[model samples]
Target: MEQRHPEKRNDRNTDLTSDQNLKDRPERQESDKAEQDPGERNAIDSNPGERKPAEPNAGERGSRERNRGERQPTERTSGERQSVERASGERNPGERNPGERNPGERNSGNRQGNDRNQRDKDRNEGVADRHEPVDRVAPDRMAGEIAREGRRSADNGSSERQDRSAGERGPADRGTADRGTADRGTADRLVVGITLGDYNGIGPEVILKALQHNRMQRICTPVIYGSMRILNRYRNILNLKDWNLNGIQNISQASHKLTNVITCWNDQNHEIQPGKVTTEAGQAAFACLQRAVEDLKAGKLDALITAPINKQNIQSEEFTFPGHTEYLAHEFGVQDNLMFMVSETLRVGVVTGHIPLGRVRSSVTRERIVEKLNLMYQSLKLDFGIQKPKIALLGLNPHAGEEGLLGQEENEIIKPLIKDLREQGRLVYGPYPADGFFGTRSYRDFDGVLAMYHDQGLIPFKAIAFDEGVNFTAGLPIVRTSPDHGTAYDIAGKNQADETSMIQALYMACDVARRRKEHQDLEANALNPKQVVEK
Candidate 1:
């Protein structure tokens, strides 16, 4: 866990100008006199008539006498000497000194000084009370300590309260405390498999950047399915020479403390032509994906986060699918799956994905839409922990077919399906114009949106959340997610690719995997209400 630093407060110079400080420390007054402008001091001595004829208190008189002893006395007439003695309270005061401040002014100045000193003292004490040790500590322990201190400061609370609060809320709040409990829990963190996408592209760059976070290891152990040599090439290019990865040939040798890399290939002299599409790069990408998927399917891994891959170059005799989603769907033997785009605020799943724009019209069937909807619904409940999810469907044509005049798909196909689903008690609505839906930001009204085609959903989703979106295959039995981007041949190896989407994909994969396990546990442990009542 990343540690937080407490802000340091500078309070050593407090109360320097307070009246008590000036009276008790004559040296401070002497320093003030020494710091005064020499011309101003000379002017005061040269024109005694301009000096304030204030009657000095005994303390002030003693300070002045000591300061005056360091310099020659100014020549004055006998009358002026008597007046000065009278101002110094040596004689009866028949008349008040002209330069003496009134009692109200003295009292106000003293009050202002005292108020400022009190405020500074209070601020310093508050900072001291809130200050934590600067050294590194576990985040959960730190959070607990902070909470305890806060409660104690709130009302002289007992240690019992602190202990109880920490016990009740510490794990839930920090998430670090709960990593030690059960299977894939505390004893062993969830091992997430990350397949390095096209080596020539920005995959290794982003993977390295995302894994550099300190919190990544605390939550789960990451195993990179690629050659360490390839990773080192990009690591050197990115100038992350200081960053290290634990290289191992198999998962058995993976380390929990460091990022583990499995050498999927043995080739050391493979040419790495970055920013260019090459068959070798595609083959290498496929090799990494195949190895990672094998581990994932064999239950050796908890989740899989695939980096961006080039759809065209990755095609081979063994891998003929258009993209990772289709390939994973086939590998897992799922006949149909939803290509879902996920972000913090919006979720969109296309009814027809990776198909030509011409084929999209024919693919917009009621069954396909219903299939994607069910997948999205289950994903929301089991993977996202949402109890009831509302879904919106985008129209195939302009103005939602304008009452069947512009197009018949929305009126003949989409509207009927939505009506049937609503009758079946599903929170489904739409056949809405895609333009107006996103233009008016109506997607915010629903939990998810079902687009009729690829661009209908992605064009807007990417525009809104390009940096943080994750493309998740919704119906897969195993968790699979990837950054919502492709191999940017233009910017590959430039070290300018943003890693936000990759990090988000990793986070979503782990979160969904954990949620699925929790859901399965709940289903397995579900109690029979009637049997319980009889007992």
Candidate 2:
């Protein structure tokens, strides 16, 4: 051969294309074929020093034979481009000289190279391309689909693969989030019907403040049976302009997503002065309570959390009952309901609630005491999820009637009921002196406590759980709770009313509803021994 200059040889080496080299050495064709698959391509690319077998097409094989000592261009495949890039040690084919062939196969151009680099980083960090880009149109996200895919992944016995398949919103995370939302919406949703107790009192203020909590929306839907005008006035007075109230025609129309208000009375002439109790306010309160009660009875509401009503003002032919407790009893046709006050720490129920103290002695009959104890026991079991609750009874007289010396009620009625209940396998305890029973915190020893009258049980309960106490009405067909504190007319407009009690009442109402449903479900499925029980 004629002598070629050293510089010319170097230029030829630099200019020689991969196909030319392949043609010059036809034996190299088999190695290129083995790395055609994208997965195999990635494996080979991960370790560029490792070589894979390749197989050339018949045309290329023939071209290699024909051009024994010459060079020629030929059609390029993606595998060929990858092979050429690998052989040339060009890490990114996209950055190759523009004069090079098959520039599209490596990555695309400058922009695409950057994108591929980022994608490679993401892949290295365990973020694979399982999901489409957010800019792309995607199908709706269904809870069932997410759950099924998760189960399928888990069943495959590769937790890493399962997580990869699930991407960021994995089966467990998405399923929990979606199921939690759905359960809160369906099963745990307490559609609380809130009656605006004397509109002029702290009822509207406390209701507004309590419902304003973001967490309230997650647990229960609130339907305020009050006037929009009145709520707006209070909202403005309390500077709670940020809170939005959805006005609805009826309870059925209330929205679960927002605090709904069903207008019970919207007379512009009616005065709405905070800290003042008026007949109009009482009538409005009664109207709201009446409407809410109707809905509650009609099954539109899960629970009823009443605000306080003025005993003197809210009395007319429409509302002749003493208060919410007596009114609810008559409405439900229950002769008496247990006035159960509940907190996280303790539970207290009274034999005579909302009745005069003088009449309390007469109300402390053996039948009444037994009835209240039975109601309290049942409430502790069903409403509170206690299987066999221990109960303590308080004396009507000081020091438990001093062994019948101070009074005869405790010895005459209370102790006999306790004795009979205990003999019947009930976990009923003593008629301990009210002062000492609560004074020494002995009430904490038992699951529930029964008092002869209102103040007897409530005084200690409020003293301990004042801001958190919830007044629950037991023995009624429906669930009803109220804040332990009454309507504070003095602090109604001033915004001095603490929302803790109302919030607790709302929480208790939802919990009681859930417990009642759970108890009913257990009763219904009691025969099935193998059935899975929910905790």
TM-scores, in order shown?
0.68, 0.65
lDDT by candidate, in order shown:
0.73, 0.72
Off by over 4 Å in 2: 1-188, 528-535
Error of 2 at 263 (Å): 0.5
Which segments of model 1 are wrong by more than 4 Å? Answer: 1-188, 528-535
| 1-535: candidate 2 lDDT, tens digit per residue | 2554434533433334343434434454444454357864455335434444464433333333332323334435334554766787775443455345434333335434564455445434422332221111112223233323423432324433333434545556655545544543454456889999988888888889877522255456789898999888887888876446788898777665568889887668886888887889988988998899889888989899999889889999877887889889999999867889888788999888877777877777888888888888888888777898999988889899899899988777878888888889999899899898888999779999988888888888998999889899999999999998887776778988998788778767777787777678778878775666768
* Alpha carbon RMSD to native, model 2: 15.4
**Backbone clashes (count) for model 2:** 8
Worst 10 residues of 2 by lDDT: 130-139
